[model samples]
Target: MSSTPALFRLAAACAAAALLAGCAVVSVASTAVGFAATAASLAVDATVGTAKAVGSVVMPSKAEDKQ
Candidate 1:
């Protein structure tokens, strides 16, 4: 089974938790931590998606073209 979806779900969960923590913690330090975690999670998700798209691109090679 592909792990990408599972990874996305996990990231989403992390982001949700961070948002909830921001609302519940109510301290400056905790709010900052929650925001940081949310940002990091989004960054990771974007990076992984970009990496997958880049990795999936196929370039035509001279050898393959001749076949």
Candidate 2:
């Protein structure tokens, strides 16, 4: 009967450990996805800014024409 209680405790510990490990894995994956999304957003902003700069150089603004 004592051995049965010890076995139960060991099983419970294992289950708790597995659950904690799963949580950690999920946290890491979500963090990585967040970083990737941020990086993609930055890249898109940079590309748009470059295109605008190029466009401005190719076609001067009406304000520039007035000046």
Candidate 3:
């Protein structure tokens, strides 16, 4: 199955143009917002992962055998 929103949008736009003679609100900003949120979440996840890898506070494996 196809899940491409852009393809659907292009089809809708084409239909609208063929049916009407005016403009349409294409909701490009909502798509941009989704992209921005996705990028931000990915960045935050990467930062947390890097901190866990390099700067994470490690607890003692043992009293004297702590890492």
Per-residue lDDT tens digits of candidate 3, residues 1-67?
4668889999999998866643323466667889999999999999999877764356433555653
Assess the local accuracy of residue 55 in candidate 3 as a C-alpha lDDT between 0 and 100.
Answer: 45
lDDT for 29 (candidate 1): 79
- lDDT for each residue of candidate 2 in 1-67, tens digit (9 for 90 to 100): 8999999999999999999999999999999999999999999999999999999999999999998
Winner on TM-score (2 vs 3): 2
* Deviation from native of the Cα of residue 49 in model 3, angstroms: 0.1
- List TM-scores for all candidates, in order: 0.47, 0.83, 0.47
* RMSD of every prediction: 21.6, 1.4, 13.0
TM-score (C-alpha, index-matched) for candidate 1? 0.47
Measured by TM-score, the strongest candidate is 2
Model 3 spans with C-alpha error above 4 angstroms: 1-26, 56-67
Candidate 2 whole-model C-alpha lDDT, 0 to 1:
0.99
Model 1 alpha-carbon drift over 4 Å, by segment: 1-26, 59-67
Error of 2 at 57 (Å): 0.7
